[model samples]
Target: MEEIWFAINDIPMDVLSRLPVKTLLGLKCVSKDWHRLISERSFIRHQLKRAEPVSGFFFQERFQWCDDDIKAISYIPVKMEGSEVQHSVFNFLPESVVLSAVSNGLICCRSCFPSPQPVIYVCNPLNKEWVTFPWSTPDKRSSLGLAFDPFKDPIDKSTDFKVVTIHQTASDMEVEDEDKDSYLTFDIYSSKTRTWHRSREMCHCHHSLFKNKGIFVGGALYWLTDGDQILMFDVQNELSWLVTVPIPLVQFDSIPEMCIGESEGKLHYVLISEGGLHVWVLEDYLDFTWELKYSISLDEMEKENTEFLCNIQQRVESRMAVDTTPWMDPLAFKDSLLFMRVAARIYLFNFETRKLEELCTLSMLGPNSIISPIVLPYSMSLIPLG
Candidate 1:
């Protein structure tokens, strides 16, 4: 028995790191040395680098009254095959907390009840470990963004994370249009020192920032704003800038549907207008240059998926059984595939083949239930949050 254990430990780390987290967890019982090797931060990093990160979607349902509010969150695996390992990833969190931001498998959640000072939590659902801290803010409606990178700082023994909050000091009625962009205050929290730093530096956002959670990509946090603009904050340099949206292809009087997402380690902007659907990629990050990647008209889409459309119409009519208005929303992007919502069904549009396939159908809650606009991207990891 002793000789067999020694032979197993002799396996090269490069080969051992390729094993799945579940297999590695079982291997830890082989010996103390094996447990130590699996628990080491360097070994964990190597395993993450060699493995494919499992991605999924988080759907949040909220109902609000004057003071009483109710919220529920559900996890949906994006893979076509029903090979999901975990069904309830966020059941570990206590009640009354809503997910704020998701980055690299770590989620930032805050208290949903109205409060001047709210308790913020950073958690890893994979291992069921979490850390909490209180944030002092007068505004209950302020926006919070989480930035976490596993390989951000090489010197640090563990992964370091940061949380940023943006809020305006004055009410919208008191602030004029010219001064609206100047009154925003930024509160930054660092995990290394476990402290919050306030910055009053001006970030020129002519429009109000969207209520949706910010997207983190390439060392920066991005938030969409009204009037076709994006607000960006650099976590490393502590600077803020604006990125302009590309002009719409069609001259539509109403506002078009727009969303920002991350794919292949780059930022992408998607727009759905009366003319059709257009996708853009940030080709040059420094110069803020955008290159249109895919453009498909509604006519072309209807022509391509006529049979699928007929089937979806029949499903919705039979299952929904309500006079609800249909909607199409872009949820997230990954590896050149677009995840979108049509009515109550989720779909994946392949950019290479120009084909669309149904992923899953969301359960209809009730006649009055409406799907929330926020669909967060999730990646599974075994990284600990301290």
Candidate 2:
């Protein structure tokens, strides 16, 4: 009976669809014929459709300089049964390298430089495969953001990813201007084409917030703009569109800057307040209706230093000090784990249990380190590909 099943060239589509992704992947090694059948794009897409999503944490190690010599350390989270495991350390990158983003198991790093023109490298730290993405123009100043399409169609599987760069262009005036109109030019680097294409469309705002605002949702990148609108850049279509967000009838000072994140397969925006944080869910992206859901008060932070928590610079610098720091950021995750970044520590707020636990503290070198740490929407704990 088993031989009869193996003898068939065309297996039932329904059976193939129902097989677990891991089982389907394992069957590829049974034989050459089986390998070819299981490796088909159609089969892979079906498997992805039924596959479950897992979360992983993305961690970075900081090094201190002693006698003009830099020494580094690594850290990892140990998931034990009950006790909070101390995170393990790993290998360190070059002295001047800074992590920009992590997507689909790839860690994107850029060589830190005084100027924006720098070398960008992406690597699968687990697999040890690294790829270098060169800049389009050597002298141009640009800021890069990396992302991958989770819902990408398997039929068009390509390892090539997307990099959005905001470049500084030559203006009509003599001196540089901070105004939005003077600062123009946006370019996209496609790994598949191995080239850069200039985008003529103007960005809706001058705020640098959108540089890291691109959040992955349904295989597309979503961002919030300074023009009081939500923008999405479709990877498949290579086009951008704006989505309206319902703004409350509050005073200008009452409206705080909004941040984008994902939760439970839906897109969410977090409104940071002096007193606490309020989370709003977008039921329909097209309709632009926002419903208030969870509201966390500052009084529940467990810490008394309200002034220090509000200072962004001080909060970042503190997180850079030690390996086991407590901090929190409004990051998107499948589970209701509110990862908050306090001074130098990260705390996990479990919505289901209504509890807050110290996750880990980030370690930094001497107080003179020049790099500013960046937080992406996704975490390494939520995505194990790192």
Candidate 3:
């Protein structure tokens, strides 16, 4: 290995950055010099730029019928055409933990319900390095968000990463009635300081924020509410506010199925309605201007993959109530690729080619359970949290 490193020591960084993350990781062990070069923040960023838009995804199936909320997390590689879901990839974490939020290549996993004290673990599955955050008291009805920017100044001693927890205020939680008024509040945990600070800001909304993972875009974290608004929290300023969703409540007779994502540092919203999947991008963040980028016809997709979808539908119907589940659910969007679920199978939709290809099938659920897999778009990175 020493001789090999000496022979290739003069290789340009541009060429080395183009190498796969796994290859770069192996090269780090060649010599201390190679390790230092690979560990530089600039090299990490350049390598990420050369990496695929999205290398793969991590998804966790939430059993709607189970109260424990303990589920197995699986990974599906995008380049692997016939890859089986890797179930043991996250075996380093506790089995009772469920995926809550993911940013960059780091994922946040929270302990299951019915615990005296709840805990959250933020880690990079690629390196298997993690940090734990245990609460002294139980936090009821909260949504966790992770905010990490690789471009942040390395010299800044304030924060390397942050975890924002949004929840109902103590007084608001005391109110048992769902129709009563309540206040939304949040607390942020800083990785650099290894401490949490509560925010003074609060807002009133019709219902609680969806427990789904928060979406990180730009420098803020966003969580969708039960109503047609999203709660946005600024990481640096430590302020929170609400932004109206693109699809107003007045426009739709009933709520439409939609999900939020980020691509190229801009927010993108995907909604499924009218026998098609509509994509809207926030072109102007300040003015809140949205532009319709793509409208894909699900009918055409169904026609092309009739046999495959039929087989998936048969398996889905045997386990879940077909009427309750959305026919086509958008899972994650990144770059030009959109990961969605038609029946129990996940597919990759490329905007450049306007084609959809099957990626993997979700795991089977118990006879009494319904599966609703939460998929997070992931790109491999070797950045360390500590």
Candidate 4:
């Protein structure tokens, strides 16, 4: 009976869909026929649905004050209990590689020094499998982002994953005084082809000017422009569209910076002020209508006198306060975990329960170290840790 099953030319699709992805991959090693069946795009996708789901967040810590000049990588299991938070270090990153973005169990890094030619590296920290792609242009300072779409065209019968690079021309010090026609261009890199292609025209007003930052959602990338308009770059079709985001009642000139993040699987925009944090939910991406969801201010917190505060006061008295404005970058974590950094400390604000929790304090590891954490599975996965 086993020999007869092994010799069969075809297997039932229904049966194949029921097996786990690892089991299917193991069976592919049995024979060339099994390999063809398991590797087929359709069968691989079916098996993927049966695979174990990965945890939500992989928290990493970097010591910017350390003299060794090395950054460490680590993982934080998702939905960890308050007492289970661990500080496990993974490995040291080589001097040439700098961490760029994290997505779908993959962490993307790039070379440190600027060159006419650049190469981007993608690695799975869990598996340690790395792939490097050549980025030929050097005059353009580029930002890298990772995106995954199950519905995109299958590559070799497998779902497609993309690495997008937003390329902008280097600014010229001399041209700032004379040239007004300076503009930036964008290009995208595909993992399937291992090549770069010019993206279709994006919103000229937004993409060309403020193209440095964007948020990934539903296989498309979104960015904010000078006028508070949201611009989207569709990964599948390589086209661009504009979305309207509702503005607050505050004066336009008072809003200093605009950043995009994901919460509860929906796109949200964060507005920062010396007063506190304001979060707006996007009801419709196409129309850009936003509803004010949450707001937190530091005025209510009790203040304590500290050496750092005294130092800041000294600087302010000396007319050096221009360099010390209090600003923060807000991040949305899974389970409605909203985080923001305040002078080496991390604050977590819960949206569902309307509670504020200070997670941990961060100390400077060095002058160059940076921390960026993003929420995962933005759709149907925004719950607080149990």
Work out the TM-score per prediction: 0.82, 0.62, 0.83, 0.63
Candidate 1 colliding pairs: none
Instruction: Give each model's whole-structure lDDT.
Output: 0.70, 0.51, 0.70, 0.51
- Candidate 3: minimum summed lDDT over ten consecutive residues — where? 313-322
Q: Score residue 337 of candidate 3 by CA lDDT.
A: 79
For candidate 4, which ten residues in a row score worst on lDDT?
377-386
Scored by Cα lDDT, where does model 4 land?
0.51
Q: What C-alpha lDDT does candidate 1 achieve relative to the native structure?
A: 0.70
Over the stretch 1-386, how does candidate 2's per-residue lDDT look in tens digits? 67686566556545765675446557667778767756555554555455343233443333333212122322223232353422222243433455555554456666654435566676655434567767676432345556665455233454557776655444554655665354434577777777878776554444333423456666556665555667765555566656665664143333244456667656777654443566777787667778877776655543544433465433333443224332344443334555454556555556556566555554432242222223443333111122
**What range of 10 consecutive residues in model 1 has the weakest lDDT sum?**
313-322
Error of 2 at 243 (Å): 5.7
After aligning candidate 2 to the native by TM-score, how far in Å is the CA of 190 from where it should be? Answer: 2.1
Candidates 2 and 3 compared: the better one by lDDT is 3
lDDT of 2: 0.51
lDDT of 1 by residue, 83-185 (tens): 5323356677664567788887788888777644568889988778788887867345677889987766531377689999888554466667676534456
lDDT of 2 at 271: 53
In candidate 2, stretches whose alpha carbon ends up further than 4 angstroms from where it belongs are 1-55, 59-96, 114-117, 138-141, 155-157, 168-184, 210-213, 223-231, 236-258, 284-287, 299-335, 362-372, 377-386
Higher-scoring candidate on lDDT, 2 or 4: 2
Task: Tell me how many clashing residue pairs each candidate has.
Answer: 0, 38, 0, 12
TM-score, candidate number 1: 0.82
lDDT string for model 4 (1-386, tens) is 76787456445555876765445557768888777776565664555454344343334333333422133332333344554334332243333454555544455666555434557776554333467777655323355666754434433343245777765443553564444443435577777676888776634442342422445666677655555566677777777766765664244323333456665557777655544456788787666678888765534221232322224222222332323433454544433555555456545545566555554445422233234332222221110110
